[model samples]
Target: MVQRFDLAIVGGSFAGLACARSAALRGLKVVVLDAKPDPGARVRTTGIIVKEASDEFDLPAGLMRKVRGVRLYAPDDRALDLSAPGYFFQATDMPGLMHWMADEAARAGATLVYGKKFESGLEYERGVALGDIHAGFLIGADGARSRVAEAFGLGVNRRFLAGLEIECEPLAAVDGRFLHCFADSKLAPGYIAWMVPGVNATQIGLAASRPQRPDLGGLLRRLKAHFDIRDIRVTSRRSGLIPSGGVVHCLGARRVMLVGDAAGMVSPVTGGGIHTALHFGRRAAMLVADHLGDRGIHPVVAMTREAPRYRAKLLLRRLMDLGPPNALINAALMTAPMRRLAQRLYFHSRGEKSESFEAWCKAFEQEPDAKPHLKLLT
Candidate 1:
């Protein structure tokens, strides 16, 4: 028997779940399909939630660990500390977070179907049909390599960063106060390697431009200089492609739309998309609801006007793809001008004249709800 829904979303991840929840809550009969057996299966990305996302979304606090500073290391091991007083990044328990998000969406009356792959769909005058389900509006929230985009002849991501990561038991020697970042062109060309003290584990990962593979072994070797890694116990590993070419040209059609990584809603330089995915995912639902229910402007047209055009970030991405020499990085990294640039890149001018990082940590620890044990180096 053929089923019917007001909205159908492919890929039950961040964007899909966010859209489904909003659409369903708005009284749309929403159905979300995913190839994975469960919402948390085959997780990708580092799951780092920026300050903006945390402020905007009501994410569960128990599944997140707040990191207040960034320790950027030069190739030669020199480091620069950066922080914005009121801003912090959250390193999440990815699987747990995904499950929570899925539960929230389901609670909002969205039907979630796992282990269902979206191979193809037929678009008619009224809507789109996928296998046994007919939907008034279809949304593709798939990953970087979107089959939906290909099937629908929408713009696809041309540039990408190949990323790999491993989650391991927390290392005692590594400081938990900062997100450790390494800029080594030889090891992670076009991108950076990072160590994040996540909610339950330590996340070590890196991404490199296409055609050049990220060297996890090289990153581990470099990390040995700062911390002992002899008996590290790994928990899980993940890898995926990150879109770095900016937003796709065509975001949607008559009764179909694309959201999240499928639409290239990722930052070309930082390769971050969670914030945009969550923000735009909710917005897409609002627009789609209006168009479908109130005869308002087409969601596609509204989304196209709202999508980000990362022109400046794309330029910076091109420069990063060149993989500047380590010698040049060593010389320029500590310079005053370079420091300013690094600060701008990491903090985005959100930092004001504030107390030292150590002082901030001391004050943060005094907060009644602070996780002091997690903040200290063991």
Candidate 2:
């Protein structure tokens, strides 16, 4: 008899591929379904993989460039430049990276099916349709707009932002390797606009969560004008919704589980998910493998154990948005106490969550997603 894949992964995104690779390597068969025939045809999120993620996962080195520093501009034009000694962030060639990862998954034994758009409502039959395909487990790593979430009856990301970006010709005299971030209520109310260097062009974007339907096009124009790059020809345009609600309410129920953006694992304040997506993707598969092998705690209960860490970040996200944007930036980024605390940020690790959150978020952009929080903050 032909071997049936033990897992059917809906979506061939970064997280999904990671899970597929992990499961397949464990000697379990796998299949990954994606709607797009070409993974790189349309980009959504900026693939700013933090150094921690790069070090954690062996991504294709040729598809990445290490960024030197970041330039953050407060709403009042007070610029704060951050460069931790020997710390860096990688700007990935997303299309190339995704395709390469998918290939790696296939090489590890995953059967990839392109142009197969998975619909929601699988849990209506308790995923019998997927079972018919010979998969005993299902992973939902589709995205924030995930059909798998609805299908699994797990609910979806309720607090999210309309994110928009443009890949364009390099900006004038800009340090190509430095990440540029801008904060202003008019352009991005609860979030920020950024520009990161890419191989052929630069990625410029703004994410807004202040309203359910913010005019991201107008905001992009304002951001372009803000940087005086309104004349550059656009190479590509990406639009998507980023979840900021910490972890989803349901991770695994019965034989189905969710990971990546579908699990609302992105950073609430920064809206970056690539790193966490990769982390949880591998982790979810490990949980599934252990469950199938009867070697660990109950999967459902184990998955929920990480809730406190993410919940803390979610609480911090709301607190950050409570104050006036400029005042928050100044008090946190421009203060003397914070200036002294910033020194230990790079030297420390995520396990030591003792530093100021402002320093953690700045470091987070270059490392794996997650802002350190006070144990008593929440």
Candidate 3:
């Protein structure tokens, strides 16, 4: 027997789950499918929720740890600390977060089917059929290499950064107040290496453009210069391809649409997509619901108009792909202009002037038990 749904989403991660929850809550019958055995299985992204995302979404406080500053290091080990007064990043328990999102979607009446691989689908005039299920509207919330895009002949991501990460027990020597980042052309090439003090573990990761590979060993070695790692024990590892290209040319067709990484809704420079994925995922649900139920504007046309172009970020990605020399980075990193640019990139327009790293640390030490709160917005 073929089950039917008003909306069907592939992939059970952030985008797909977000869309499913919104659609179902709006009275639409929603079904979500994924190849993973469970929502938390084999997580990919680092799950760093930026200030904007935290403000927009009411995420669980227990699953996240707030990081108020960024400690950026040049190749020669010189560091620059950056922070905005009201802005902070959240390092999450990725698997736990995914499970929570899935539970929320289920609570909102979305049917989630894990361990189901989406092989192929037939899009007819009325709906799209996937195996034994028929959906009025089909959404591809799949990863960077979306089989849906390929099957639909939609634009695919051409440029990519290969990323590798390892999660281990929290390193006591490493300061938990800042997200430690290292810029080294020789080690990370096109991208940067990072150490995030996540909810219960320390996440060490790196990404690099095409020809270059992320060197986890090299990153660990570099970390030794600033912190002790002799007794470190890795618990889990993850690797995946990040889309460094802008949004795809074609986002959707008649009754089918693409959201999240499938549509290349990712920042080319930072390689961050969770924010866009969540934002656009919920947006896609609204558009789909309106178009399918209320005779509104075509979702494809509306989504195309609303999607982010990332023109400047794409240009920056191209430049970063060239990989700047270590000597040049060491020379220019501490300059006033470079510092201002870094501040802008990390904190945007949050605060006019940032407090010194040492001062911030001293203040945080005074309030040892204080924790950052989520500034949720309506």
Candidate 4:
């Protein structure tokens, strides 16, 4: 007997579960599939998100810890601290959050199938067929190396950053309320290093571009030399891939759609995606719901609407990769004016009149002395 569902979701992570719950809430018979038996197992990502994510999504409050500010360190040991009175950088218990989302998805009427991987699928005139399970619409919420994307001929992630992190006992000297970021081109070219304060410990990690040879292990030693954290004890270590190239080449085809890293919805500026994932997950699932209801909301339209912001960020990420991290980090973020510009970009530089991406990019091109660095926009 062939099983069936109104909406089928692959990968039971943040985006997958969010999509499942949204679709289920829309009265769809949603079924979520995952290879992992446990939602929390083999957790990746640092799980640090911006304040806007917490404001936008209804995440579990108990799993979140708010940090006061972010401190950026240049190679010369020049540090720049920036924060608003009310803004926060939140650290989340990622694995626990995933588990909670899975449970919530189940509660919202999504039937979750664990320990089972989705195989190659077939498409019919009405819907796509996945093994014995026929789904009216299919959503690919898998990670960067998305099997669902490959199966549907949606292009794979063109580039990636290798990330490594270690969780350690909190150092007495380092403020537990601050998130620190380091930019040293020699240590981590095309990317940055960070120490995020969690509820129980500190997370130290570095991400480097794929093409460059990075002295990743030496980064920790350097961080210690800079910060005086010689007594910190290690609790755990992790390494994973961070999707680059912003948006994927294709997000949806026919009744098939992709979200999260599978769709390359991560920020090139921060390597953060939880906010983007949740935003798109809800939107994509709603589009699917509308499509099933015979509304003419095409996936192409959704992709078109979402592409501009990711493209702008991709351009910024490319500009950051053009030179040594030291050159840009110190030049762009060290000074007061630069930090003010950074604030605008982070907060809302999207023009006083129109909240368009071109206006946001104008924030860079229009800056004084930006011609030498930000000539691309003109």
lDDT of each: 0.90, 0.73, 0.90, 0.77
lDDT of 4 by residue, 218-254 (tens): 8878877767788879987777777878887777788
Answer with 1 or 2, whichever has the higher lDDT.
1
Flag regions of model 2 displaced more than 4 Å.
1-3, 120-128, 210-230, 322-333, 337-378
Query: How do the candidates rank by lDDT, highest first?
Result: 1, 3, 4, 2
lDDT of 3 by residue, 142-252 (tens): 989998888878888888999999999998887788899999988889999999988889999999998789888988887886688778899999999999888998998
Question: How does each model score on TM-score?
Answer: 0.95, 0.82, 0.95, 0.86
After superposition, the stretches of candidate 3 with alpha carbons farther than 4 Å from their true spots are 360-378
Q: Give the least accurate 10-residue stretch of model 2, judged by summed lDDT.
A: 369-378
Clashing pairs in 3: none
Clashing pairs in 1: none
Kindly report which residue stretches of model 4 are placed more than 4 angstroms away from their true locations once superposed. 325-333, 345-378
Residue-level lDDT of model 1, residues 1-378, one tens digit each, is 999999999989989999999999999999999999999999898999998999999999999988888988999998888887777889999999999999999999999999999999989999999989999999999989998888888889999999999999988777788899999999999999999999879999999999899999989988876788777899999999999999999998898899999999999988899999999999989999999999989999999999999888999999999999889889998887887777777778876453467776676677767655434433
Q: How accurate is candidate 2 locally (lDDT)?
A: 0.73
Model 3 lDDT on a 0 to 1 scale: 0.90
Q: Which clashing pairs does model 4 show?
A: none
Tens digit of per-residue lDDT, candidate 2, span 1-378: 433567889989888999999999987778888888876666787888887899899998789877755666776667655555445678888899988998899999888888878874344333334534656678888999788778768768888878888888877645664687776656677777787877566887887774634445765665555566667778888888998787887776777777888888887866778888898899888887887766566556777785335655577568645534566766576665554433233223322334443464455556543434221111
What ranges in model 1 sit over 4 Å off? 352-355, 362-378
